[model samples]
Target: MKGHYRKRGANTWAIVVELPADPVTGKRRQKWTSIKGTEKDAQVALRRQLHDLDTGKLSHAEKLTVKRYLEQWLDSKARSSISPRTHARYREICEKHISPAIGKIRLDKLRPLDVQRLVDSLPDKGLSRRTVLHVFRVFHNALERAVRLQLLSVNPASAVEPSKPDQADIAVVDSAGAAKLMDEVVGTRLEVPVALALGAGLRRSEILGLRWGDVDFDDGRATIRQTCQLVKVEEPSAATAKKKTPRFELRFLTTKTHRSRRSVTLPPSVVGLLRRSKASQSERRLLLGAGWQDNDLVVERGDGKPVRPDTLTKQFHKVSDRLGLGVTFHGLRHSHASLLLKGGVSMKAISERLGHVSASFTADVYTHLGRGIEEQAAEAFDRVVKHER
Candidate 1:
């Protein structure tokens, strides 16, 4: 419905019409085409474009730059459909990886070779295979949307195969190592959070999001219904030239996946630890009196404010370095899973306990831990045959 005519050369005129805003970039979209002759010809062309736009036929005339189209596509289509974190990640990928490479190419003229060249160049730029795969996925998904929108005849990204990432090596601590680490952290602020990660296999975000209400002391269980994490916010355009650092704010979001919202039975040791943590918090609240923020979070700062996930990670790293533990905070969760697997826990049970989408995924991730189980199974089979003989 938005159209206009402007003088071009002596006898030529240009017709311009505003289209839907780019979904990715959140920028305005405009289509411009030239017509030879007088003002009458320009007005006629403008009317036709307006009519086409109104009837959804203007897609045929789209001559958008790849950068422009990606911006528009992400803003209009992807913003509402995806999580804020995922949307931000897609935007980062587009800006950092895709835009610098082939963004100026005409959307209609983009070729598979162009995409392949970009993918081939990523490794030379020092990106890992996993990160390169993520970049490819974002680009591929955007192109798929473009095809659906009739912006492209075919998705060029579909012709370029993304490289598969190598299997990740997981580091886990033994029972003795975990016990020593726990003893070192005794009576420290990290005690409860570390216990949750090592004993209950809770993710860092899940531990931060836990509240007193989520814990059932009588039932000896805890429910993971939400997660808290700090997400980076885009800086204002006016502040960009000042080199202002990006800001991050704590946000409480739904569990990572549908299966992530599950219940975990608490071990008696963890229960006792939680009880002691609660008593310590109660003493602090009494001392602070009216100054206390009372957020009821199981893991929080002294003022009851949410603990920043990054801060927790840094502190854990410092403690691990001092103790020479040689394990990350996530290693605690890996240790918990490894211990459970070694104790003969069923794969399905472990998957559910870890809130995995499927037991197969759990088994795949813990394949190294399952080797001992194979030996145990073989031993049991031998015993059965010997008894029968």
Candidate 2:
């Protein structure tokens, strides 16, 4: 009967431990340890918890629902350490889908089919595949945390089929198209960050996060160190539109992957473009006076605030529409990868330059370009054999 566990509720099992409470307040809080399973399973859990207590891993039980725990996870696990944009994404998924369905479920009772049901409801609820998948990831992450905290023994979301949309072809504005885009950028109101996207194939954030110090004009090299994210903060008061400051402020942080923090050599033309851009940014500093917030190098307005990464994308789209061109800003990044592959650069080299986490990832994304280059190589071998014979 020692270390005997009692079924508290649902899938939750616990061992009751009595502790003195405040007699004045008449609040005698029940001290219970969380476990998940039958009596036999509880014995093993009891040993683990006692072992954890001996080793300093056992903590208090919170009868927290999936919804409450998710909020705690986001605030503690995400908002405390991660980028603002990332927190926004986690919060959005929790609100739009996960919170609505299984958020009320106890953390211990979450099942694989429960996760599947969440994904299955998306289409009927008019949510996109991408949104549904994001929600799934959030739910998976929550369950993963529960396992980490020893609240649950398994991750249910891992067992379920993920909602993957019919993927559209990888977009690329080919070499000639890229050149056209760059030329148009030069003539338009688009800034240097915009130019960098088309010319160098830098992502919008990478371009906007670039500091003057990161740019090495003499060596034509640039180092990626940080990303600028729009952190969302609650606005307490209704202020005048003109007087309203940003509810979301830019916070500089590291790249998503370690490889993303890389140094790349820019072409001479791109270097010149950056130099001009730098001078323009300097002029803005003088105009903004005390209003400017400087973080160096990233192409921000004269006021020193970094531009939202998507602002460049929206601008690029507008320009493309004006020029009667059909292209996404991301197409420029794809084009860069294609050009590298076509030039016979090894996937590893291309992966590093593009900040890809793995060479396999590079190979997967640019498979079409690699296939074309491989075909050309085969044709070259055939030509050489016939000529030699």
Candidate 3:
């Protein structure tokens, strides 16, 4: 039987407890649990807490240190509400970045200045501004969960100023530069694929995910219904090995966003390039029958497997470096959007082609690129107002 609980403070009270006999020590001991509220409330609270201890609900009540609490937060996160890729990123940041920096620190004792010092020290540690921000974001999210669960009274990360990223001028490759760059790829293995990326505003992953069947020459359009992404895995299981391991398959999966999965009209130049690339692939398949991988459309090798997306960046950089273009593979997509904008394409039309959920997003990213049109608009405004003024 338990004794009567006594009020210790406003919204809190304490209960004297007898520790169970220790066989080795051959003695019982006294202990105490400080619970919050009135006598009846404390009774109910202590009973519920004791129940929780027996049922594993409050398993950590006795040993819920900051590190333990952080682990529980991370574990719950991994089990729900996140994609594998996103979860992996969070896990890496927690383990490699945040935990190493402050894992042993008491969560309740963590001051805003302590966090600020970490952010302040990031630049000296060779962390990129973006990476430091990411580390802070991970901790912020974890601590937010802690606060919600009553493990933390408040989010310490929220009180600290977040690290800011340094801004670089938006890079946009213009029309003439795009044409000159396209000319550089005219003779290489990258010709057709690079053309599609530059001309269609297709992401490199989306291009690699494309298939010959996805194109409609009669309709003069191609459906961007899928995107390829790399995922690391251990050795294949028996079931996976039997079916050619679908991760490696050119298995058509849905696009990343519903807005991105759309039918885009192909230009005559790109349509011809696709025709040529397909015909060339067919000829190569005939040459190597059993040796061909044969799962992807925009394949890089004769083996027919889908092209690795990162290789495109490497190749693009190589070409850009060779040509002194000051552009990137991603710059090709920017070039595509820029040319359309410069040619007086409407934001809605460009958004549709680029698969942006909203034209506002497109407008936001290319504000500098869109400024040229604003300049023209201002010139027209001057013409209209100059005589009146």
Candidate 4:
């Protein structure tokens, strides 16, 4: 038997477990322990030891620390599992939050109370409630992997209560504010970007990643193929740091999700505006001649390089603030959904338009906008009664 227990006294029992043969000596190995409890307790102890031996966790448990294991997990994840931005965020959470808290503890010795203490202490570290929750999730996910790999019998994080962050309000621009925004950007560089955002509801990265070839002027359509990301450049080792390197680099990545890779029909006004933008870009290309760098990007610098996504967000905020709109660039996307919701559009339609994963998620986000729909429903009922009369 792999394990067995025998009663030794009125309240004591002896447990014996068979372990794998010693590698060097090729001799069978066994373990024996005494339990000062009932026969059931001795049986449990015997079974636990057998399971640990089968999983091989007993060998690594004493040597592996939380910080070392997490670093190794991140290195494996960096290969192909997650996007570069997500990997960077995960690493930041590991190094800045998790490691500082419980990283020194042996992985096998980690307990639910230890995890709870880490969660409780994060707010004192000046982290926001949302960020604290994120750290908890990352740590929980790592521990879950450990359980699946037979490194742990259970995930300690599963027993800890997660921090609940207050939901922040979603800001949206009213129709009048959207009109004013369009009017203000008429002759400025913000024209096309603003048009795509307020007019068609593209994310800032998607707007910056748009290429001329992705647009169809005649069909009034644009395909979302890629997105731009500003990723932090990894610090080089001492030898490589001698060479100068930029702090950040812009990269073109695929869409955020399968749903995010979608086609959006442009409003006619946006199409017309884009036509003008194309003409203007052509003139600039001619002026630069051979010096022009043609990256085929629809929105770019005069020399034909992609616009940094943050620069677009800052410029958009500047205009919105000047106009007293109080709306951020992303707020414009919320405004787009608000405007559509007010026009009797269904939540499912808006979800598909915005490339959200599900209509229910879209409805939850724009639930505040449902008052207008309720009002419209009441008006429709009154009209039916009047027609019957």
Highest TM-score scorer: 4
Candidate 3 least-lDDT 10 residues: 54-63
* Model 3 collision count: 3
Candidate 2's C-alpha runs over 4 A off are 1-62, 187-191, 237-247, 279-295, 302-305, 386-389
As for TM-score, the candidate ahead, 1 or 3, is 1
Q: Tens-digit lDDT track for model 4 on 1-389?
A: 37788888989888877654532234676667788987777778887877776766553344468998898778777886466889889998999999988999989899999999999999999999989999999999988887776667788999998767775678888888888889999988889988898889899888888999999988899999888889877666566876745478888888878889899999999999999999999999999999888888888977898899888888888888898888899988888998999888889989988989999989878776887678888999999999999
The TM-score ranking, best first, is 4, 1, 2, 3
- Clash count of each predicted structure: 12, 3, 3, 0
Ranking of predictions according to lDDT: 1, 4, 2, 3
| Cα lDDT tens digits for candidate 2, 32-61 | 678777778778877765565444244322
- Give the lDDT of residue 107 in candidate 4: 91
Which candidate wins on lDDT?
1
> How do the residues 1-389 of candidate 1 rate in per-residue lDDT, one tens digit apiece?
57788997899888889877654444678887888998888888888878866654566325578888778767864536445677778888888899899989888788999999999999999999999999998889888888776666578999999788886878888789889889989989899989999999999999999999999999999999888888877675575776646778898877867789999999999999998888989999999999888778999899888999989999999999898878899888988998898788899999999899999999989887788679888999999999999
Compared with the true structure, what per-residue lDDT tens digits does model 3 show for residues 1-389? Answer: 24446787787888754333321233554446787667788788777756543443432222345565567677787677444456657777777766677667766566677677777777787989988888888877887776665445566777787657764465656767778777888867788767887899888777878877788999888889777666543356787675533243223445757789898898898898888878888888988899888676764556687777777678888888887888778778878898898788998899989999899989877777788888988898999999889
lDDT of 1 at 199: 95
Which should have the higher lDDT, number 1 or number 3? Answer: 1
lDDT of each: 0.85, 0.73, 0.72, 0.84
